[model samples]
Target: MSPSTLQAPEIAMRPALRFITCGSVDDGKSTLIGRLLYERQLILDDQLSALERDSRRHGTAGEGVDFSLLLDGLEAEREQGITIDVAYRYFATARRSFIVADTPGHEQYTRNMVTGASNADLAVLLVDARKGLLDQTRRHAIIAAMLGIRHMVLAVNKIDLVDFDRAVFERIVAAFNDFAATLGFRTITAIPLSARFGDNVAERSQRTPWYAGPPLIDLLEQIDVEDDRSGKPFRMPVQWVNRPDASFRGFCGTIVSGAVKAGDEIVVLPSGRVTTVKEVLAPGADGKAETGDSVTLTLTEETDVARGDMLAAPRARPQVADQFAAHIVWMSPEALLPGRSYLMKVNHNSVLATVTDLKHRVDIQTLARLAAKTLSLNEVGVCNLSVARPIAVDAYADNRDTGGFVLIDRYSNETVAAGMIDFALRRATNIHRHAYTVNKAFRTALMHHKPAVLWFTGLPGSGKSTIANLVESGLHARGAHTMLLDGDNVRHGLNNDLGFTEADRVENIRRVAEVAKLMTEAGLIVLCSFISPFAAERRLAREMVQTGEFIEIFVDTPLEMCIVRDPKGLYRRALAGEIANFTGIGQPYERPEVPELHLLTPDRDPAQLAQDVIDELIRMKIL
Candidate 1:
């Protein structure tokens, strides 16, 4: 149906199908998309004119039109002439609607392909009839299968170039069908077509008179996708608040799956609070809504609901847990190791999660998953996740909205993977019991102010203390209760026993972070100036605070500058072997790659830097 036809009343409509094109770089994936769009007449007049202009501009290379150029928009992509990231395109046909994701073809960019096909309902795995089943196609199909996309259409593209030979097409089709069936992709549709010549895209080709089947578009439109979101309870993760009126705030987000009616008993996840829907609202006077509709929902009671929380029918509420096993596809260059915490984005909620164990590495070729110690980039494995807090979710097969998540490296902030949750935690691996003592409010009552921690980290003589002292004085003058934890001061008491060794350094940061955490709980702004040199340590310290508490000020003065401004002659003595294990002299300090505040030495003025930090805090509503 045309998009305009979707506006018709009293007609039961089929939902749009989301699919991805997977093949080698020159396997005609892009050409297939362009052909599909062309036959559907989706291209605007001006757009076609622009395409002609670009064709003339580029002098027209290759066997046919450079259809790959249609999706490669990045300058680097156009220059290197390869798709890197996943590119999404939307178009509708007279029979059905389509959402296509174009993925990269490079072997190294297999991670990109997994990301593209993760949310797809079907995958159009293209193959060059001339070059039957390449390793790249096999790799992509394995990932798609692992990610739970069952339906695949084997588009044997570029058959026209092969003289439209029936024997050739049949041989390639049989080989791929056998491979796909072996890989557990049962519903494989092997279609013969030439994407460049627009044969069998929207219309059945007359070239192969022997094969009698529906056109590709007919199969796409006829395929049932209602079951994708059907037979499940209502689930809509609150994405934003629509405050059309100050008196009321309506929860707004796309209905991920299932149906909801007015007065449906809804349960807010991770909280177990129950409430009935007061109204299921759309702009129009609608009776009900299915999946993919953006609507506002008002509850009976004014319960505190925000982004990163799921709203579901009370009868089918998802399971809550702090640990779960997932089939994780590693997407980063770094290896997944034990004791490293990853930032997990489960549904809309973000949590600090660590892996309990690396179960096995999935052998894509042999289909035998082997027990392994680690997973590298583009590798698939089953691993267990342990979150810092309890999260409500469901099995991926039952509910994709609640079951999928991206794992981010806590230290590097790089998204390491796309994970499909298997089931709820079999054994409770709780990070901590849900307990709120000395809450943010209670801390404010005792301290008589709002709590914040000025986390200063730098080399030994890089002016961290100088800047922190000036900032503390400024905050004190402003009637904000502030405490400055200088490394010198801490060495006299709490961290006195600690030393310059790696273990002692880690312990020092931990102690300081805990103190800062406690001070934040009491609603006091504390300034901490220490040589907390490690990125991992600093990130862990930041994660300790709930919000508006930890402020990292990186005194990024150069080592040479620190040595020159060594007020205590520590740098001079360290060079002369008097001061042992001194930072910037003997000990290594990992610079703050992304510091909240970057400040130079005292000669550049510390008071101004402190004021800048204060201003930033106020602007972020953390003051």
Candidate 2:
């Protein structure tokens, strides 16, 4: 068969491939992409002339045009000769079409690479033949695997510099294969090439005749790029409520996965409202809708459906929950504040959300899970998130659209993190709040006094527990039901598993505040004494209780005084470097700025402070 006739069969059988190129800096990624475009005749004559002019002025190719200039369009990139952002390019050959993303190779810009690779079908990892696989190469490969790129092409670039030795190519391939096995990649292809000289990219290289493999272009053209969602259950997130007229209503969005047709049984998630598909309207299409189609769907019966609501097949409905365990990539310059509220955008839905716990941060080099309190820029961590309301979501491995989300700063509107849901916490769906007939109101009426929680916070050795004990004693003497929760005593039983790290401290305060809330709801006065160094965690505790029922009491004792009065010898241990993460020493204490009551403990006796608290409670009508 003639070459043209042979190419016709391959052209009719292949689909467009979307892939990304990434590795360490100066690995010839830009040059490889530019060479592919040039070979395909995608550049215009005017563009070629400008490229030649630019090459003459500032070129690294000596006498030839510097192909790297074609993709590095940013001023900073040109000046520094490094990629800083993801650059997307489109081109086609006689056999196949391609969409390629040129991603950054620097460690600080790893987040940009993640953004580009999120939608790619494959990855082309470039490696310097002289340096083999560097740390950045391993990082990119791991990230690509995490983003679900199963197909990889390890292009051993700059082969010309290494004299195109077949043994050198084999050694690099062996090492990469050993490491790639641990990543669970389905397919890995290694090729010997020189992107600068255009060898083994579009054409076979004569220098590496000892190595036998197809060129890079042939491998991309013949690879299967079919997705597995074609036969899965249908899912669509409502993007907008289409109300063209008083009589017409529809839900408009793109079908992210699976297939749907008219008369299919569907349910609106989190609401659990059942409905049938009345009509499926696609742009100039028949009566069916499939994945990637943007259409308007009308239900058989009128139901209250709005933006962020998910429509899914009733038999394969998604999990509805307000809490989830997720993997997050921190993108903002500011570190992730554990208890601070941020706006979470999942598909078309937005909700107020908080990172409730930081499970662990992944070490990109060693792939180890390290305990962490906060995630910094370009860091990856596992965390638990709590949303204001329940949302219909799937595990990210099952469906990317419904399981991926971004956290935006509420004040600045800047995107702070990118997250992928692993799964909903079991308690979120398994446990339900059961209401009892005898409630807080009946308990308060029986006690003949309003229930209240007095939270005492200060530095260590600040006389908080001493004052709290005396106040509880006074309340008991007056025939009032009361309980006192001292930090040390509770830590010995309830929070025995917790430590002194910031993350553990947050959990400790959270558990204690919850117990106190329950006690107050039982119609008893509750006193909580703890250092509670972080203001954010303290605020979270206050939010768990009823408005006006939580009263903050600040024990204003100077740090120097607490150190001098070191009752537990904790300060001495901290000063001697025998203890770590001690509040007032290694960690910081965020003092309450506007407590309901402030007591100066410098010259006051414990009984006097206790009497003052009782008098204040009486004035507030709590007695």
Candidate 3:
């Protein structure tokens, strides 16, 4: 039986179907939205008047009601005649309620679609019948799949422009299905419609006698949506700390998953600290509330917890890690390269981070794997990340709530990229069964002392290797086990196969960082002197070891001093057009925005600088 046929008559407070619409500017998205709202009688008279006023404001068509003007908000967005931010609308019929997200329709704004569809249970991808299956369609579909949106409805809009030709609709559906088959989405309900003419939008159309199916709205009302949160694990990310009084402390947030009750055992993440729920709070109710309800929860323990911490069932807790692997989408005009740090925001929480390594770039057009050194604008790639602080996270597949993160420029606060967590590096494991017996103490004994790494990052010929060797000899005389990875010595042998390109520079630093990490793990004081040049690479090397185990000592030698100290004369040749990728002479070097320690040259003696580095290490208590 049809669901509406036997349903009790009542108002729907919340939408049963959550969907978003994405298409190019000329695809008539706003017209379709207007049609849905108008037919459902959800449009307020004031809203219609506002749209009319806006229509005349933009010198729109008279009386006919400018449907496009309905969605055009913001002067800049309307001036450009495109959607900017994701606009949400709500409406309902006698049966199921509808929540629609109208997202921007530009190739560069692919990241916005991800944000819109991340929470959507269904996605309605409208395609211009005249312009059959475009790249935007594929891009939107893949994003919906990536965000775990399974249900899909391909609305073949603008059928009136196509002369109601059945072949045109079939051809478009065939093309989309041909490509979409490769991905994980199979439940697609394609329909023909003309939002401008109001055909096949609310009811079955008489225009297309050959096509017999329920209208777009009817299909939406009838389609089954499983929001059964009863069986799923409970998750509540504390978004607000509500301390109504000093005596009452309540953690407030929306329940994204299963139900929780008073006195239930819950664990706060990244800490593994367990506690009991003292109060299951509704805004003002004591009764049980299911998922999708915003409420304040008070735990039994009077322990201190604040925003960015999550309350979930202890058994299904998320991983706590300071570093992780993720699939990142580069959205900024500036390409994403290693050796640069970014701020990562996961869910409601944010942290500082760096793209340590780019694994492989995914070809959106062909779905082929392309080996890339850096991520260009609007590119998707797998990469490793080292965060400044620990984040409580889960795999994108397991839980979208904690799996996704956004990369922001640390200085500017501009959101540069969006990332999906693949796995955590220092992921919390079964402490009961697993053991980390090889701690820092075990490594220190084997190396005859403690494990330490000297990370030197600066412009080329900054006397990094010269000072490193001198320090290594001094430390050796004191019977300190040490290894010196000079830039010239290692490049000639260990990294001889690598080049001096931007991609090669990242790879060189990555290999060196890994070697230093291994050396520290093996309990040796390793002096890694390289013109790594990028602050991000230096930070990654530091993150690999425990606090104080890795030290960043910047060789503060001027470019002119480096040119004079160039034993290979490479810098001089670079200035004379003999070399192309020489740092400080030909290529640009990003000065260390923040360094742990700085050593000056041509001003301070080499011995003083070396001793200064040693003194800092001893003070840090890592010696």
Clash-forming residue pairs, model 2: none
Q: RMSDs, each prediction?
A: 8.8, 4.4, 5.3
For the record, the alpha-carbon RMSD of candidate 3 to the native fold, in angstroms, is 5.3
Which pairs, if any, clash in model 3?
none
Most TM-score-accurate candidate: 2
Cα displacement (Å) at residue 75, model 2: 4.2
After superposition, the stretches of candidate 2 with alpha carbons farther than 4 Å from their true spots are 1-14, 44-66, 73-76, 243-246, 285-287, 321-345, 350-390, 406-419, 422-430, 461-480, 552-576, 591-623
**Cα-based lDDT for every prediction:** 0.78, 0.89, 0.79
TM value for model 3:
0.78
The candidate, 1 or 3, that scores higher on TM-score is 3
Taking all chains together, each candidate's TM-score versus the true structure is 0.68, 0.83, 0.78
For candidate 2, lDDT tens digit of each residue in 475-540?
999888998999999989999998887767877888898899999889999999999998877787
Question: Model 1, residue 316: displacement in angstroms?
Answer: 1.7
- For model 1, how does the per-residue alpha-carbon lDDT over 317-406 read when each residue is reduced to its tens digit? 888888888888888886676445578997778888877777888776655779876688778889888898788888886777778999
Error of 3 at 183 (Å): 3.3
lDDT per residue (tens digit) for residues 206-271 in model 3: 888888878988888877766555566888888999987889999888877778888789898767
